[model samples]
Target: MQALRIAATGMDAQQKRVETVSNNIANMSTTAYDTRRAEFADLHYQQLRAPGAISSSTGLIAPAGIELGLGVRTSAISVNHTQGSLRQTGGDLDLAIEGRGWFEVTLPSGDPAYTRDGAFKKTGEGLIVNSEGYPLAGDITIPQDARSITINANGEVYAYFDGETEGQQVGALQTTIFVNEKGLEAMGGNMFRETQASGAPIPGEPGLDGRGAIRQGFLEESSVDVVAQIADLIEAQRGYELNSKVISAADQMLGSTTQLR
Candidate 1:
């Protein structure tokens, strides 16, 4: 009976691992997506005999103890914050970060959110917003009559008008960094919200003080590796099958015991 319970926990843990790997593989094409990994910890152990206990017959002390582990449990599902590959889109509004930092956007509820997805678009009112229509922080606006827009590595936005031979500064963009970026909570729509674990957001200009430089006309791709995920999937499947076999063996043994009349 104990073996049955222990093996059941293993099956549950492997099921969760499979789900996490599947999600990562599914998002391989998602822009700025980070893969998540399932972490597990061994359950508590039942100590049948204490270490260094004196043996009755030989009066000798034992060096090792008899302990049985309960099972495994999922500890945490952490996201990998590694940088993804950048692809050029040739669009004026598309942007990507070359290193660390994220773009700040205001949600519809007026809450501040951060995102690495830089596939932004200019609204009808000339306000820079993400694909979800969430406006970027600092209220950057482009002039409607501007012939062309230029964003530099420093995140400075400039617009060239017809009569003006020189480009005029429209607005500046800022990047936000966190003390513990992996601690941020991932909200849907390629956004993340600050949590107590993530600490406060550190605002700064791009390409300064460890902040990543802005790359216009480019977007960051998802960091998931398909081959690795497939390997993990196969491993999890094997683990699940082994645990199931253990349960089956335990059941047969129990059946034999009941058959003894």
Candidate 2:
């Protein structure tokens, strides 16, 4: 009976691992997506005999204790915050961070949200916003008469008018960095919110003071690797099969005991 329960836990853990791997594979094309991994810890051990105890018949101390692990449990599903590759989109609004930072956006509820997906668009009112229509924190707006828009590596926005040769400065962009970027909570819509574990958001200009530079006309790709995920999936499948075999063996032994009567 104990073996049955222990094997069941293993199956459960493997099932979760499969799910996590599948999710990562599914988001391989998602912009600025981070891959997550399932971490497990072994359950408490059942100590049948204590080490150094005198043997009943031999009167000799035991060298090692008899311990059996109960099972395994998922401890955490941590996300990898490593930077993804930059992709050229050829769109004026598309942006990518070359180092470390997230774009600040104002959610509908007036809350601040952070995102690495810089596929921005201009609203009807000329306000710069992400695909979800959330406006950027700096509220950068383009003029109607502007012929073209230019964003530099330092997060400066400029608008060029038709008649004049010189470009006018519209607004500046800013990026937010977290003390623990992995600790931020994913809020869907390719956005994240600050948590206690993530610490407070540190606002900084792009390409300055350790902040990432903004690359215009580009976007960051997803961090998931399909080849690696497939390998992990195969490993998890084998683990699940082994655990099932353990349960089957335990059941067969139990059946033999019943036939002894």
Q: Residue by residue across 109-182, what tens digits does model 2's lDDT show?
A: 99999999999999888999999999999889999888899899999999999888878999999998988988
lDDT of 1 by residue, 103-153 (tens): 999998999999999999989889999999999999999999999999999
Please report how far candidate 2 places residue 79 from its true position, in Å.
0.8
- Please, what is the whole-model Cα lDDT of each candidate in the order they appear? 0.95, 0.94
- The top-ranked prediction according to TM-score is 1
Q: How many backbone clashes does candidate 2 have?
A: 0
TM-score between model 2 and native: 0.95
Cα lDDT over the full model 1: 0.95
